[model samples]
Target: MMGRTVLVTGGSSGIGRAVAARFAADGADVVITGRRVDTVAPAAEALGVRGLACDATSPGQVAALAGELGGSLDVLVNAAGGLPAAPAAGTPPLEALAQEWLSSVSGNVLTAVLTTTAVRDRLAPGGAVISVGSIGAERRGGSYGAAKAALAAWNVSLAAALGPQDVTCNVISSGYVAGTGFFGDGMTEERHRALVEETLLKRPGTPDDIAQTILFLASPGARHITGQTIHVNGGAFTTR
Candidate 1:
């Protein structure tokens, strides 16, 4: 990883931060991005990596990010995403639903799509494109889950397109990762216990768990593995 260049979006905290830390530790040139300068700047400084503030969904900002790279990239991690904001009180039901669904798709799916597109040409032959998905896509994930499901579907085509260049693309579908501020005020003690019980491992997943999986996918050993959705959940959801 000495000469490799890696980019991670939404890397200010949580799983993205963990991924940046891992690659930086291995001596890779790592750059992290978040929407806010306040968050991105400190996280980058603390992790000893470059930080760029860019809203991945915006084409203009993404293009700027690409221009800044001005060279090749070895890894791109689409780790920036989350649930949509709650609608204002008394907002029309249909309008609220529309906003929620649209935001969900944009935040989870388009972020990856736009960011990857911006850096696609910059990705070297041995590079890997990895996106963070969620278990919500399987259960009662609602709009958020549906967006994640869409992300997996998109990865297949992306892998095919990038395969000829020796660039592997995949999605890491995570489940019940703790300490991510993902659940926010919605998570409860009872719910947490139930989630852990549902997993065969009887434990919650963590940022490092997802980070490690991304590292493996970007390594030489996983060169043959692409265009597949890799579930990192702790046996909470089974695939047939």
Candidate 2:
């Protein structure tokens, strides 16, 4: 990856940060983005990579980020997404529900779609576009899960479109990865244990676990793989 240019959205922390770190370690020209400058700057400086503040869900911001790239991108990791904030208090229940659902889809699905669209032309042939998906999409994930499921559905179309150009697109559907602040402080001991127990590995999934998988997808070895939702859930969710 010495000559590669990789862009990781939401790379200031968690799995995105780990992915950026891995690419930097391998000598890729890495650029990371966060919604806030304060977080993006320090993270980029600490990782010895370029940092930009871009809201992945905003078309204008994402377009500007593409312009700043200046060169073709080799790998794009769409890791900018999370659970939406709760709706304001005193709002009507129906309105609050609508707000939460919309926010969930925007943060998770639109973030990936808008960013990828903005940089689609900047991707060189053979470049890879990888997005972080979730097992929640498979079960009782509610609106957030529905958004992730939509992301995977969208990836299939993207892969078909980009396949002719020799660019690859895929989703990494992870299960219960720790250290991502995914559940915030809501993860109780019993809940954590239950999640791990569901996995065949009987252990927690780490950021490195997902990052290593993303690295492989971006590598030459995974060149033939595209339009697929590869599960990295320690067997917590089985396909067959």
Candidate 3:
């Protein structure tokens, strides 16, 4: 990864942060983006990478970020998404439900879509575009799961479009990962245990687990692999 330019969205913390750190350690010129300047700056400093505040879901922000890069990108990691926050105080139940669904789709799906579109032309040959997905896409995933499923679907077409350019596009469908604020205050002990038991490894995944996979997918060894969703869920959801 030495001399390569990498961009990771939603890299203020958690899986995104881990991925950025791994690339930076490999001597890549890495830049991380987040919605908040305070968080992004601190995380970038800690990882020895540059930080930019840009909302991936917004075309304006994404365009500005691309302008800032000003050159070809060797890698683009679309890690800028999560479970949607609760709807604000509302007068109607149906509207709140609709908002939740929309939030999920915009946050998870649109973020990847807009960001990738903004920088598609700037992706260098041999580049890799990796998006973070979720196991929820396979099972009883609600709105969030549905959005992740869309992400994987989008990746297939993207891979084909970029294939002729020697740019690989893929998704990393992550499982139950610990040490991240993904669950917020909603994760109960029982829920945590149940999720762990569901995995063949019988333990929650770490950020490094997903980070290491990103490293490989961006490497020369994975040059031939593209347009596939690699599950990193500890056998929680296996595919034929």
Candidate 4:
């Protein structure tokens, strides 16, 4: 990855931050974007990376991000997404459903689609795209799972479109990532235990687990792999 340029969205925290740092440590010129400049800027500086304040859901911001780091992109990681605030207890079924579904789709599917479309041309040959996905899509994922499922579908079309350019696209479906703010304040000890129990490994996943997979996909070792979703779930979910 020496001298290569990579971009990771949502680099202010969690898996995004870990992935950005990992890439920077590998000698790649890393660029990170997030909605909050204050948090993301400090993070970028700490890692000796460039920080861009861009909302992945905004087309204009995405275009600007592409232009700013355009023409030399070797990898793009769409890690800027998550569930919004949960609905109030006892809220109407329609109202609660609407909010979660919208938030999930906007944060997950739309963000990746807009970012990928904005930078498709700037992506270099041998480049790769790695989007953060979820194991939720397999269970009763609700709106979040629905959005993640859509992301996988989009990846197939993206891979086909970019195949001619030698830019492979794939999704990394993560499960039970520990040390991340994925659950916000609702992750209770009992819930945590239940999550661990669901996994075959009987342990939670770390950001490094997902980051290493991203690195592998971007490396020459995975040059032929594309249009597929790789699971990093610690055996929480399996496909026979």
Candidate 5:
């Protein structure tokens, strides 16, 4: 990623922050975006990168961000996604479930769609689009998993559209990445043990694990790789 300008959404924290740092360490001109202006600016400055305050779910904000960068983007990492704090409740029997599902869709799927659409035209030739996915989508869970499944499906079309431009699009389906907000408050000892037990490596993943994969996907080494979901789950699940 040397000399490349990479943009990581939701870079204020978690996997996004790690991705931004990895690219910056590789000498890329890194730019990170988050809804929190204060958090993003300081983190970017500390990491010797630029910061932009843009909500990935908002098309206008994403467009303005692209304009600020002079409309030339080399890499776009869609890492902004999570479940809502509380499910939306309603009078109808299934209204809460419906609202919760919508919230997940808005957060995980729509956010990536809006950001990708706004910058698709400005993406440089040979650009790469990497979205952070979750193993939750494959596990028994709620709307969050469903949304991630949608994201993976959407990336397929994106890859096809950008293939001719030499822009590869892919998703990294991560698993048990520790030190993230996926556990909400935090991971307890028992929960951590269970997660590790389920993995072949008998350990939890880290942000750097996903970051390294993103770096590979963005590099010339992975030029031929596109329209695929690469699992980074330590053999938690495998395809025949």
Candidate 6:
């Protein structure tokens, strides 16, 4: 990865932070972006990489980020998303449901769409575009799941279009990963145990687990693996 330029959105924490650190460890010129400057700046400094503040879901911000990059990128990791927030109190039931659904779609699907489109021309040939998906897309994923499923669907067409350019695109559907605030402050002990029990490994996944897969997809060995959603759920869900 040395001398290669890697861009990771939402790299201020969680899976994104891990991915950025992994690439930086391999000597890649890594640049991480988050919506907040204060958070992203510290994370970038800690990882010893450059940091940019950009709200990926916004076209204007994404365009600004692309402009900052000077139209050159070797790898793009779209890890800028998470579970949707709960509906606000005093909101009507129907409106609350709608808000939750829209939040999920915007955070998970729109973020990737806007960012990838903004940087499409900047993507170097033979580069990789890796998006973070979720196992929720498989079972009772609700709005978050639906959004992630859409992400995979979009990646297929994206792969087809970019394949001719020697670029690869794929999605990584992650399972119940630990070490991040993904579950926020609502993760109960029983729920945590249940999640771990569901996995064959009987343990929750770490950010490094997902980061390692992203690294492989970016490597030369994975050139032929495009337009696929690779599940890293420790046997919680299997694709036939």
In candidate 3, list every pair of residues with a backbone clash.
Answer: none
**Could you estimate the TM-score for every candidate?**
0.98, 0.98, 0.98, 0.95, 0.94, 0.98
* Candidate 4 error regions (>4 Å): 87-93
Residues 29-145 of candidate 1 have per-residue lDDT tens digits of 999999999999999999999999999989999999999978899999999999998999999999999999999999999999999999998999999999999999999999999
lDDT of each: 0.95, 0.93, 0.95, 0.92, 0.88, 0.95
Deviating ranges (above 4 Å) for candidate 1: none
State the lDDT of candidate 2 residue by residue for 1-240, as single tens digits.
678999999999999999999999988999999999999999999999999999887889988888888879999999989897788889999999999899999999999999888888889998999999999999999999999999999999999998998999999999998887778889999999999999999998899999999999999999999999999999999999
Which 10 consecutive residues of model 4 have the lowest summed lDDT?
Answer: 64-73
Cα lDDT tens digits, model 4, 1-240, are: 699999999988899999998999999999999998888889989888999999998898888888888567899999999986588999899999898888899999999999989888889999999999999888878888989999999999999999999999999999999999888987999999999999999999999899999999999999999999999998988887
- Give the Å shift of residue 52 in candidate 1: 0.3
**What is the TM-score (0 to 1) of candidate 4?**
0.95
Model 4 pairs in collision: none
The true-versus-predicted C-alpha distance at residue 33 of model 2, in Å, is 0.6
How does residue 123 of candidate 3 score in lDDT? 95
Scored by lDDT, the top model is: 1
State the lDDT of candidate 6 residue by residue for 1-240, as single tens digits.
Answer: 689999999999999999999999999999999999999999999999999999887889998899998758999999999988788799999999999999999999999999999888889998999999999999999999999999999999999999988999999999999999998888999999999999998899999999999999999999999999999989889887
